[model samples]
Target chain A: MMVVIWGVVKFIVLLVLLSVYVLFMTWFDRKVIARMQNRVGPKLIGFHGLWQPLADTIKSFWKEDSIPRGSYRFLFWLAPIIFTTCAFAISFVVPFAPPIKIAGGVLHFSVVNINVAVLFVFAFLGLASFGVLFAGIASGGSKYPYIGSQREGAQMISYEIILALTLLNPILMSQSLNFETIVAAQTHHLWYAFYQPVAFVCYLIAMFAVSAKVPFDLPEAESEICCGYFVEYSGMKMGLFPFAQYIVLLVMSAIMVLMFLGGWTGPFWSGGFIAGFIWYWVKVAFFVFLFTWAWGTLPRYRYDQLMDIGWKILLPISVLNIFWTGFALSAHLPFF
Target chain B: MTQIVFFILSLGTIIGALGTILCKNAYYSAMWMISTFVSMAGLFVMLNAPFVAMLQIIVYAGAIAILILFVMMLMDRRVLNNKERFNPQYFWGIILGVGLFSDLAVLAFKFRINITNAGKSLTLHGSNTKMVGDVLFKHYLFPFEIIAIILLIALIGAIVLTKKDEEEAR
Candidate 1:
């Protein structure tokens, strides 16, 4: 069937494009961060350090794979494999832009736009925590990684709830779990960010925490835990975590754009497929660039402080934001 | 194509469930259980209930399995030495498991519900999520409220138990 063939082709294309995007992101991130820090990053490999990630990838992938002694062989293998799978799977539902009309047929940019895309997104994001938990626990009984995994588990457990709560803002407004409908809602109304600023702020903080960016990167804090969960890992095994994190960053940025930033819709180019794709790509790029700037600027959060922020602060604000959004909507005010 | 996906997912779930028990190491058992949960989610998705699929993964695999793994992590590694592979109850356990499986198999075939035309039968409005909410809020409202009450009670009980543990630790 044409549908089946198209599905297979789309899967293959998504996989290749995802890898290429992740690889290039390494250089993109380093260069942007370098600019933030007033230094040149990876200029030798190619123009303005474009091919730096390609060189980095080749070196990391070809290096020897070794498992430390006393490691549980099965789990040592399982962690990174599942971690990367979950990370890549999260990108499947992210739409590049709104649907475009081509030859009088509508084309959805997402790989699969399911009925309950919101829940699907939350589920996979939650699943990533298990990979971190197992990776730390299976590190040959290392005390350091065990501690790191515990913190990782605790942080994800706390933040995932807040993230789920914050997601309700757009879900409430659109009353649909489908990403396409949510974007359509945004296109009709103002971006949710302008309407639900409280929820938006809470979600922004939780998003960084979820992706383990700086200020929330305590799980694998290089200075303190000395690589934490992947401390004993080397070569591609070690490099895979960063690769997965890059994918997570992309997914998170894409979701924020879709949910809050009026995905694929900008001025002067409102409704065309290619134009919407371009607009979506531009917004996502801007988000990634902003994230790198934050990564370069912020200090990592202390462990207890991270927990406090997730539970004590963001959790309550997010829960209250739901009520606030509901009240505002009920009032039917100009802002609402 | 649907049959192929269902076959693959069902086989995976069965294999994972068996592996969960067969694997002597606690950590591997937890991993197998998680995989089983994932396969179950795939089955839910195949059934065209995406919300249930998400909950299956999020609640069972993400939360429950992670909790089990946390306990597995704290355990002394030597205690899992698989010295005695089988317990004395093994014979009865197999018999009971087989008995349950056969009963379920018969019931599964007998009670088909034939959900292919259920949506048409109801002629409900809106998306699947909306239909689910409408049914839960209108027809099954009492049971839904009861479930919520039960869950809240369970949560409070857990908090109390943990608070007790803290006091005893102090």
Candidate 2:
């Protein structure tokens, strides 16, 4: 019963948080890109276009949802829901703030504090690619979406290995699979990032690739594929894809904070729930801003280049990082 | 209640196993396989092996399913049209599968395995995870190290197989 109730509450909270994050991510992307281009962006809706995302959301809700004729109607409808649900579910084990006291004095941080939190996150994120593949096949588009889906599938599989191996560094250091316990371990010493900088770099690169962010967004390279897997979607149906993207970003950032940056272990201002929440959000926002900056600076990679980087560069580096981390741990190094 | 949950999960596993054999499309077959893995994981949890259950979900359902999907993506779509060759073999496979399943069912029903009434609480001190870790590092350390070495060799072999052959040819 507690599990069911907590699952429901977490679902609602994630839905609301993801919606708000998607809204602001749009605003941030547009505003940042516009500033780069030396032009104004969405200054009409409210003060400096603060309400622009809200307006856009309302407009999308009212727009007609179209299904292309002869498409696989069932998979088409099921794709986004499956994708978004998996993306949202990855947050169940991710601790956002320190444990908070509820009405009955019961303490909880995450919805599901399972032992294998890190593995669960990667597994769910990997499942999310199905949404893209199914959407592409269901679109009844020519060969482009199929090709795009293939590319996306391959890219995700390649990077997922690196992502898992990179995370193994911290898991090895902490010697625990629970996200909260990992964070608690970091508090006793220095952050994992300090000792495992190479792993951190590999993790950051893999995160971008897994999330399909800039330089690795070849799946939906606008110039080539014209929205790729979601070419046929419009209005609210199309909106769910970006919404899932925002949720992925949020979840990945939260994982990074927990695994590497010492989640909820910042300098104490008041040493309460509010302080922990503030620090958590601050770290997440900083990473999100870094992603935004990446979007503005980097050009998308070619398909072969992306694969080469994953298989050749990132995978080797991550393996080496694991060895280095193990050696350091055994040597009783003062780095962390 | 536990019996009801086990019955439902076993039913799901059987249905999904049948679906994997019966489905025409390879993608659909993969999805059914995933469903079977998930249901099997549920059975693992019911047997008080949460770590094993989670591993079932993570490694098999997650990683292996995705790998199969990748293989499916690489296959020629025209191969899916060759249904005539698959029908006979699929029938035989299902017959053998059901026969094995029933034998296992009979064995499971006959045997009464004793589960020690230890490590039932959720305390962090002596949970299954801690015990498993301790046993793994202490008693089974050499085998664990051997497994790591084997995995490393497999990784290198994969890299070599997938590498370009131009330099070797020269």
* Best of the candidates, lDDT: 1
Top-DockQ candidate index? 1
Stretches of candidate 1 exceeding 4 Å from the true structure: A267-269, A330-335, B80-95, B105-127, B165-170
Candidate 1: DockQ? 0.64
- lDDT of model 1, residue A112: 77
Which pairs clash (backbone N, Cα, C closer than 3 Å) in model 1? none
RMSD of each: 3.3, 3.7
Evaluated on chain B only, candidate 1 has a TM-score of: 0.76
TM-score of chain B of each: 0.76, 0.75
List of clashing residue pairs for candidate 2: none
Among incorrect, acceptable, medium and high, the docking class of model 2 is acceptable
Candidate 1 on A1-336: residue-level lDDT in tens?
765676577778888988898888888888878888899888987798788888877898888888878888778888888889988778777776677666947666677767788888888887887888888867888877887888788777788888889989999898888888888888877888988888888888988888888879888888898878888787888888888998898888898888998888886667777788888889888878767888889888888888888888888888888888888788986766
